[model samples]
Target: MSFSSVPFFITFAENPELAICAEDSIKGARLVLKPFKNNLLALFNVDFVQGLFGLATSGNQLVIGAEDITLGAPLALQLLQPESGKLQRWDIFSAPGNIVSAADSCLAFGYRLRTKPPLQLTELNAPPFPQWIFLPFTTTQRGILESAV
Candidate 1:
């Protein structure tokens, strides 16, 4: 099957060996992914078992987000070395979530809400908002109110 047929997952690697491993892993399961380019392998159609949804390189570690079929729809992050392939997994949440964005030190995740949405921020590890100042005026501050009964 052609890689273009897959949904959406991409991995950029400069190391040829690492890229090969990624391609093998994706294709071994009879999955379609974008053709590897310049030693980079891009995975698409990531809805299959243990399908990869996101990937980011942070310093020497690679952060990966994948669907864990054993746990249902919970998407988890795995930190690993591309060269060594040693990894540790961290569960983010269960209800069909994916890594929406990533930076040098952080990643953003989005989840599907099932019930009435409460007022809450969904971006995980989001940066703090700037503090704002509030000014309140007393009733006596008004000249007409001070002069009236």
Candidate 2:
């Protein structure tokens, strides 16, 4: 991924150390999932999430080798977005199919998740190396997408 494609959770940090480390340590992993529709999962495109990963597995991360995300195991995810200079947190039921288009800026994505923590990023513990499926988004792009919704 390009610098612009990095997620806001990895950027815009008060402590540059964590932000810098996250940026450099940032890795992409793919998910293998089956088709799903309606419900909260429908907001994202599962096929894209799998593609973001390397299409294979390396230690903790699984790379997407195919379009079907249903092939992989279900892992927990904490969705974080930049809000009021802080990251807003949500725990959503996300699978590979839950991921959608990520803008070049990597701040947001097209899919929405059912926040497990009720949209509180500060209250959540974002694991450093938890198995994840990420989608990059830009602030401008998110606005447009949200408007459509």
Candidate 3:
């Protein structure tokens, strides 16, 4: 089976020595393994106090929003595919006190105040990945989203 068919986790070490070791090992394995490490798993946690609010995706990217009781505003996370020429490591962006919502090809995010003007949603164009080509359309319109790659 290919690496894409398997489940794995990616981690980064903060210590300089550990970081260097991890990088070197990954590089060595990639050199010998050919196209290994070409996929990544994106994991999200929903604390007991925080409940899931929304989910949105653009291409290989995903944004998850949650309502945490401790915070005044919702929390959002943006996950993106790793850049080419590197081990398949994903990127994550976290936003606290941000109102995030999504619909169709649009994504709305930012802070808002009571009685203030509403913020506009940002239009997200199709990404380069084929898996996200039909993301803007409904399941009924585009059929089931599946991949055999």
lDDT of 2 at 22: 12
lDDT per prediction?
Answer: 0.26, 0.22, 0.21
Q: For candidate 1, what is the TM-score?
A: 0.19
List candidate 2 segments past 4 Å from native: 1-36, 40-83, 89-129, 135-149
Quickly count the clashes in candidate 2.
Answer: 20
Clashes of each: 3, 20, 0
TM-score, model 3 to reference: 0.17
Q: Order the candidate numbers by TM-score, best to worst.
A: 1, 3, 2
Tens digit of per-residue lDDT, candidate 2, span 65-131: 2111221222222122122111111122332312221211122222113433211111112222122
Least accurate 10 contiguous residues by lDDT in model 1: 130-139
Residue-wise C-alpha lDDT for candidate 3, range 1-149, written one tens digit per residue: 01121111211111111100011122111100011122112212221122221111122233233222221223233332222211121112222222223222123222223422211222222221111111111212222223325
lDDT tens digits, residue span 12-88, model 1: 12221211113223211211222233322332233232223333122212333333222112323334434322111
How high a TM-score does candidate 2 get?
Answer: 0.16
Tell me the RMSD of model 2 versus the true structure.
Answer: 17.5
Residue 59 lDDT (model 2): 23
Better of 1 and 2 by lDDT: 1
Q: List all candidate RMSDs to the true structure.
A: 23.0, 17.5, 18.1
Best by lDDT: 1
